[model samples]
Target: MADEVKLLGVVGSPFVCRIQIALKLKGIEYKFVQEDLANKSDLLLKYNPVHKKVPVFVHNEKPISESLVIIEYIDEVWKNNSIFPSDPYHRALARFWAKFIDDKIVTPSFKSVFTVDEKEREKSIAESTEALQILENELKEKFFGGKEFGFVDISAVFIAFWIPLFQDIIGLKLFTAEKFPNLYKWSQEFLNHPTVKEIMPPRDPLFSFFKGIHDKLHSSSK
Candidate 1:
């Protein structure tokens, strides 16, 4: 039998979208099963019992959780459309920066956007800004690690897409062209890439979806 692949994911999720981008880049055919994170399905729980999260990738009968791990697996399994650098050191650097993006930018920015506490929100914003400045200085090329859109690019899906949406929802002016010109340019390139653009959720629906969450958070805090 041929290879069987399935992605259990929620719509409008940057994490899920990144995996989709990776799959599309590799020209892999797979089924996307929409998951309602509010009431997660048995498969999600079964496949990813530890995290109990969406974006659980199943190949044949094996399951893998975490977006970065799944992407790496996809890269290893499919040689075409390589996602990481060929050189050992460069590959190590790619992993390092990807981890930095997650730990520094993605986490802090997300906390800044979603938290109701003013002090906590400000702290997160500051942390995110500091990390973003470091990224801006490092990002001198078309993509991370030079030309090709590879591992680090996929890892930064949150910064490219979701952070802007979050900024809009919360009326925060965190990431902008003036503050980080290199990142602005990079986001444009990453967002417009054919493989990435094809799988990205439309802005209007995504905005509305996130707006509802923001409104709910504020109302609860009140």
Candidate 2:
């Protein structure tokens, strides 16, 4: 019998989706335990003692934190379907892009939507566009990543999934069909995957719900 796996996540999180994608790819059976960020449960706090963040995967009895870490662990443990490249160099390259996004785009992308200040919005846009440009240049000749769906492709697909929802929040049109054709095509390909398409939140619900949350978080902070 397979080990019992439990995931602590909030559907609102793209971070949670990363692990969910990997687990589905590996055909793992697991129970999802939803966590409320505003009032975190004891399980989430216990599993993720340091960060106390969602998307924590408990495999058997061992707790794994961080989405990327959880995904990599899934890829390793369930080796039948691999997310990283076979070659060591290629695997390193994939990790490089993942790290780049974590460092460059993720935080600013979140801030871009929640921040009301013009300066903050401008900064987020500038940083995000620069990061996107790097991806464009690197992945130009690629379904998404260097002839096959690899780790970089997996990490990048989130940009497409969330960008439109984010545009609604920011009241802008930075990511569009015409603006980034390559990225647009990649987005369609990534989202069209049966597993991804099936599990992802619908645009109407995700955007409307997150918009309200964004407004609430910002308002309460003021």
Report the number of the highest-TM-score candidate.
1
Worst 10 contiguous positions by lDDT, candidate 1: 106-115
Worst 10 residues of 2 by lDDT: 139-148
| Candidate 1 lDDT by residue in tens digits, 34-128 | 99988989989899999999899999989999999999899999999899899999899999999999999988887886789999999999998
lDDT computed for candidate 1 = 0.91
lDDT of each: 0.91, 0.80
Model 1 quality (TM-score):
0.97
The list of candidate 2 runs beyond 4 A from truth reads 216-222
Error of 1 at 52 (Å): 0.5
Task: Give the poorly placed runs of model 1, Cα more than 4 Å off.
Answer: none
Candidate 2 overall lDDT versus native? 0.80
The TM-scores of all predictions, comma-separated, are: 0.97, 0.92
